[model samples]
Target chain A: EAGVAQSPRYKIIEKRQSVAFWCNPISGHATLYWYQQILGQGPKLLIQFQNNGVVDDSQLPKDRFSAERLKGVDSTLKIQPAKLEDSAVYLCASSLGTGNGYTFGSGTRLTVV
Target chain B: AQSVTQPDIHITVSEGASLELRCNYSYGATPYLFWYVQSPGQGLQLLLKYFSGDTLVQGIKGFEAEFKRSQSSFNLRKPSVHWSDAAEYFCAVGEGGNTPLVFGKGTRLSVIA
Candidate 1:
């Protein structure tokens, strides 16, 4: 099966700039997630969606980050006025059912200078 | 709250030797546990997961994980180490079904020939 798809693979932006990352989850999967992975650390959840509805987003930097899964399919994560600490890999994952193992995309590496 | 911990920041092992990566989770109840591997410039891949059944669960790429409820641990192990097995390993826990996972800081493995 085709895996979750992510775009850009890499990005570089100055502080206070804006950036967006796109993701397409595996077909038939309804649960989608966005995570940020900093250097020397593990990926941290930014948001989660169950069929276009957000299930959780407690860790998201609401003032600078936003995400959407408009059609319950493709999703996008946007960061406005990026901070230097925002530099990290953005990972996208999808699960067929609740609590199932996720299939992930290659991820987009963002560097905020 | 659900949390995961990886005690080792990094480890080096010789080829053909045994390998082990420790993981411990804290949760109020029995949680779904998983092990994932991340290669440089790539995304996370499922190594194994334990939701129920036998404590020892095998995964792809010659990896396995054991869930110990008594210790609140789900450690990954490989009987024989390989150069290609060197990568960042993460342990995660979730409530299952529309819940997001809590991940550890990760442990980097280096396999020496």
Candidate 2:
């Protein structure tokens, strides 16, 4: 099967600017997730969507980060007033359900200057 | 708080030699464990997962992991190494409910001949 798809493999933005990342999960998957992976660190979940309804967003920085999954298939992650620290890889993943495993996208690498 | 630990930040082994990557997770109840591999500029790919049934589980690319409840460990092992196997390996954990996976700071492997 075709893997999860992401757009703009790399991005560069100035501090305080806005940026967006897009993700398309595998067909028929019911769960979508957004994660942030900083350099030298592991990926951290920012938000999770179960068929368009948010399941979790406890770790997301609400002031700057927001995510949405439309029709429970494609998702987008946005960061407004991006901070220099926001430079990292934003990854998207999906799964069939709670018990199933996840497949990740190549990620959008953001370089905040 | 729940967390995952990768003891080795980097590992180097010669080609055709045995390989091991240690992963330790902290959680209250029975956990969902996973191992993911990330190539340069690529997204994460599932290596194996431990949900139940078997303690020792095999995955793609000749990789296997043993989940030990008592030790809180799910260490990845490979009988022999290949240069193509050099990549960053991550350990992740997820609890029941809609909680997203918590990842460990990956272990970067380097294979030499």
Candidate 3:
């Protein structure tokens, strides 16, 4: 079986520019999550989705960040007016259920100048 | 709020030597623990998890972890190290099903011949 898939393994953008990352979770997985991993730091949860509905996004920077999982399958995370501090790896993961182990994607490395 | 801490930022060991990576968690109640490994430019892979029952858990690639409830710690260990084991390892804690994982900054392992 194939693992979770993510696009644009690497991206470079300037401050104030917009950037988006795409993720296609494993088939049949019901839980999807997006995480931000800054250098020398752990991966922090940004948002979580159960099917097409959001389950949690408490840590998401709502003013600048947004994510969507349409049709309960593919997902996209966007950042507008990106900041230099936003330069980090964005990871996507999926689980069969709420408490199961997750399968993660290779992640997108975003560098905001 | 739940949080995880990986005390060591980096660890080095020679092949065939034993290895241990420390992890500590802070949570109000019983928390689910997990260990994940990530290779350079790759995604995070689940190594093992501890929910209940046996405190000692075995994972893939000869990895094992012991969960000490009294100390609020879950430390990963391996009897012998290999060159391929060089990677970053993360420890995480969660409330249970549907909850986002709180992760540690991670410990980078270096194996020398």
Question: Best DockQ goes to which candidate?
Answer: 1
lDDT of 1 by residue, A61-112 (tens): 9999999999999999999989999999999999976457888899999999
Q: Write model 3 residue lDDT over A20-78, tens digit each, in one string.
A: 99999999999999999998888999999999999999999999999999999999999
lDDT of 2 by residue, A1-113 (tens): 99999998999999999999999999988889998999999999899999999988998999999888888889999999899999999999998754567899999999999
Candidate with the larger DockQ of 2 and 3: 3
Please report how far candidate 1 places residue A77 from its true position, in Å: 0.5
| Candidate 3 residue spans exceeding 4 A from truth | none
Q: Every model's DockQ, to 2 decimals?
A: 0.82, 0.72, 0.79
Question: Candidate 2 chain B: minimum summed lDDT over ten consecutive residues — where?
Answer: B93-102
- State the C-alpha lDDT per candidate: 0.93, 0.92, 0.94
Put down candidate 2 lDDT per residue, B1-113, tens digits, no spaces: 78999999999999999999999999988899999999999999998988889899999999999999999999999999999999999999987555688999999999999
What's the chain B TM-score of candidate 2?
A: 0.97
Ranking by DockQ: 1, 3, 2
- Candidate 1's C-alpha runs over 4 A off are none
Find the 10 residues in a row with the least total lDDT in model 1 chain B. Answer: B94-103
lDDT of 3 by residue, B1-113 (tens): 89898999999999999999999999988888999999999989999998888999999999999999899999999999999999999999988888888899999999999
Docking class of 3: medium
**Worst ten-residue run, lDDT, model 3 chain A?**
A95-104
